[model samples]
Target: MKIQNKRLFASILFVLISVLCVAQGPPYPGGGPPGPPGFPIDGGILMGVGVALFYGVKKILGNK
Candidate 1:
């Protein structure tokens, strides 16, 4: 029980940190995405980071 709680807490913390880091980080080095002028470079990069983190967390949880 304690271990499970710890794992849950750690996972939540990891996600929060990942989000904050991505949100506060610099914009993408290159110009914005191609189609329809997608989101701004910074927004695009942050979204990409968020998606990556989401998948990463999913993989980690699924594996265990």
Candidate 2:
């Protein structure tokens, strides 16, 4: 029971940190200043990586 509680706490902390980091990062940098509408390719690549990681974790945990 104690181990389960610790795991849950750690998961929550990890998620909170991930959310904070994402939120602190810049979004659509092009809108912030005079730019060429930001780097769409980079954004797409980042999104792809995020999706891959999400599914990879799910698969590894046998959650899917």
Task: Please provide TM-scores, in order, for all candidate models, with all chains considered together.
Answer: 0.39, 0.39
Q: Model 2 reaches what TM-score against the true structure?
A: 0.39
The true-versus-predicted C-alpha distance at residue 8 of model 2, in Å, is 0.1
Q: 2-40 in candidate 2: lDDT tens per residue?
A: 999999999999999999997774565754645586556
Distance from true location, Cα of 50 in model 1, Å: 37
C-alpha-based local distance difference test score of model 2: 0.84
Show the colliding residue pairs in model 1: none
The alpha-carbon root-mean-square deviation between model 2 and the true structure, to one decimal in Å, is 11.1
lDDT of 1 at 1: 68
Q: In candidate 2, how many clashes are counted? A: 0
Q: List, residue by residue over 1-64, the lDDT tens digit for candidate 1.
A: 6999999999999999999997874455565544565546678898999999999999999998
Looking at model 2, residue 3 earns an lDDT score of: 95
